[model samples]
Target: MTRTRFAPSPNGPLHLGHAYAAIVAHDLARARGGTFALRIEDIDGERSRPEYVAEFFADLAWLGLQWDGDPVFQSARLGSYVHPGERLKAMGLLYPCRCTRAEIAAAATLFGPDGPIYPGTCKHKQVDPEGAAWRLDVAAAVALSGPLEWVDEIAGSQRAMPEVFGDVVLLRKDLPASYHLAATLDDAADGVTLVTRGLDLFASSHVHRLLQALLDLPVPTWHHHALLVEPDGRKLAKRRGSPSLGDRRRGGEDGPALAAALRDGRLPAGISLSRSLHTGA
Candidate 1:
């Protein structure tokens, strides 16, 4: 059975971009007689809120989207997030890095997908595990995987090139898993068959494909739809204070109508979809 999930972090309200993503996932699953699952990526430490969790349910319902089964919470699966990193560490594919962002920026010379591609400053160093993050050795990982590929419904087939992100984080110093590790595991665990998300996250699929190969998880086809963005091409984001679904609902806008209009390519004035591939993933 085809399964898709809308996983949102409870850091803030659901913006239009989020609405677009959720609607796409929900509609695709319903149209195919598949399952549309909801997942709360609430493992953002203290930045995640309980109220935002409740709000996601309300906002999704108002938008005429119904999920299958109970929502999955990343917080509840904390233990499960650790084993992957541990296995990688044991396999000598992960190393503890104590470098801060400022430290990395000072030493970095090359730029990659996530920016300044970690210069491997800490790759050979033996940093204390207490205050360090575990980074994946992408070169070694790709060598082990021996060429990986994944399919995208919109962007077509892709070659897994996680090296662009350099030594990406597998485990965070504070969290059991970084976004890369957690998201890859979460989708697999939810049995998501089609990962429908905005194009802003398009690059992330490469790393995810590599992880799936390394851990021997099921690979799923992805659908990276266009992102709803401002006229200037800035993607609608919670951090950007984009008008939220809850505010729209509170303002007496017809939720179902809004979704319908969005489906019909009717966006609010001056809003457009970004077609850029250089977005921050």
Candidate 2:
């Protein structure tokens, strides 16, 4: 079956961009006579809120998106990340790094698609901190996987170059798993065949492809859509004060109608699609 998911973080209410992404995934599944799944990415211990999670269900329901089965909560799957993490560790492709963000910024001489790439300061360090993050030795990982490539419906064929982002953290210092580790494992476990999301995450797919190879997981195709932006071309973000869909719902707007508008490219005033933020890896 062609399965796709709309995984959203429960850190804030759904905004217009999120609505667009969800509708796209839902409609794609519907078009293919497949399944549409919802996954709650609530692993951010400090920021995730129960109230926001409830709002997510209500908003998706209001949008008329019917997901298959129950939603998968990342918080409930902490232990599932252990084996893959341990597999990497066992292969000696994972290392503990105690470097702080400030220290990395000070040492980073080259920047990749995701900002300043780590300089591998602790790749060979003998000392390990109590709560150090576990980073994937990207060069070693890629060499083990040999040459890899993934296909994107929109971006065409992409060569997987995990080294672009340097050594990415597989386990965070404060959490059991990082986004790269948790998301990749969850997608494979759920049997997702088509992964769809915003173009902003296109670069992160490169890292994910490598993780799939290392963990011996089933590979999935990707479709990274353009981002919805404000009139000034700024991408909609909760931190940037982008208006939430809840507010619009409370204002008496019809959810299905709004979804149709987005599908038909009939965006409301002050909203536009932007493709200016493409990233490479």
Candidate 3:
């Protein structure tokens, strides 16, 4: 059976942009007579809140999206994230990284899919692993994988080139797992066949593909859909304090009616396709 998932980090309220992504995933699964699942990416203890998790259910319920069973949360599955990182480490693909953000910015000379490619400052250093992040040797990983490829429903076949990302972090200093490690592992564990997410994260798929190969996980198809943006074409992100669905709900707006509007390509006055938004933002 086909399975598609909508994994949202419960750091803030669900906004119009989130609504679009969720609707897309839910509809895509239903179209194929498959199952739609919801996953809560609440691994970031600093930002994640229990109330936000409740709000997520409320927003999805308000959207009238029927998902499979209860939502799977990342916080509750920290143990699952460890084995994959350890596997990579056991293969000598991971090294301790004590380089701070400023240190990396000062050392990086080339730009990758996401910002300055991390210059391997700690790759050869004798950094203590006690409280340091674990960095993946991307080049070594690719060497082990021996050329890789994954497909996206919209963009078609993609040649995996995680080298551009330089040595990416697999384990964080404060946390047990990085976004790349936890997300990649969780998707495989949940048996997600189609990964549906925003266009901004499209580049991360390259790194994820490499991880999947290294960990011997099943490959899944991807759909990096266009995003909903503010009137000025700015990406509507929670970090920017984007307006939330709760605002609309509180205003007595009809959830299903709003969903219908979205389906008909009729978005609210201020929200539209992000013509100017970059994919790697």
Candidate 4:
């Protein structure tokens, strides 16, 4: 059976973008008669709140989305998250690096690959004196996954060689799983055959594919839908105080009107009116 998951971190309130994603996942599952799962990616215990988690469920319900099986919590699966990293470390595919955020930011400025590109200053250079974050060895990444191919349902098929990402973190020094590690473990464990999410995460796909290769997990299909953005054209973020389903519901706006507002370009890059009209029940 087809299986997919809508995994959201409980760092803040669920916004319109969250509904767009959840709606898409729910519709896809219903169309295919597959199972849709909900996963709470609350690994960042410092920021995630119980209230936010409760709000997420309430928001999804208000938006008419449902899931199969019990919701999975990444915070509770800490042990499972470390298993893959440990396997990689045992094979010498992971190394400990002691690098601070400031140091990484400095390297990112010098290197041209984007913010915090990780200059590999600690990659095989020297062992961290004390506790360190474990990074995947780039050599191992290339050796294991030569090249990756993914067919994004929205943006078309894309390919990337593992070398592009270099060494990535599997485990933080604090011993918490990074987003990449937790997502990889959960997707595989849930038997998700098709992975769908916003397009902003395009860059992270390489890391996920690499993890799949390293863990010998099934490489699922991908569908990267467009991201919802604010009126100012900036990407919508929970931190930016975007209007959410709860906000609309409280305002007494019905589902169709909310859908119309989203599709009428009140928000940027949301589903087009044509798509929304066709998708509505």
Q: Which candidate is the best by lDDT?
A: 2
Worst 10 residues of 3 by lDDT: 272-281
Q: Give the TM-score of candidate 1.
A: 0.97
Instruction: Give the clashing pairs for model 2.
Output: none
| Per-prediction TM-score to the true structure, in the order listed | 0.97, 0.97, 0.96, 0.87
Compared with the true structure, the alpha-carbon lDDT of candidate 4 equals 0.73
Q: RMSD for all candidates, in order, please.
A: 1.6, 1.1, 1.7, 4.8
| Tens-digit per-residue lDDT, 1-281, candidate 1 | 88999999999999888888999999999989999999999989898989988889999999999999999999999999878878888888999899999999989999976778899988888778887888999999999999888898876778878877899988999988999999999999999999998887788888999999989899999998988888778888788889989899899999899999889889999898767854423
Cα lDDT of model 3 by residue, 1-281, tens digit:
77999888978888988898999999999999999999999878679877888888888888888899888988889887777778788999999988888888998999977688898887888888999999998888888899889898888888887887888888998777999988888889999999998888888999999989988899999988888878677788888998799888888889999988887779878778753433432
What lDDT tens digits, residue by residue, belong to model 2 across residues 13-111? 889999999998999899999999999999898799879988888888888889999999999999998888888999989899999899999999999
Query: Which sequence of candidate numbers ranks them by TM-score, best first?
Result: 2, 1, 3, 4
Pairs in clash, predicted candidate 3: none
lDDT agreement with native, every candidate: 0.89, 0.90, 0.86, 0.73
lDDT of 1 at 164: 79
Minimum summed lDDT over a 10-residue window in model 4 is located at 272-281
Which residue pairs collide, candidate 4?
none
RMSD of 2: 1.1
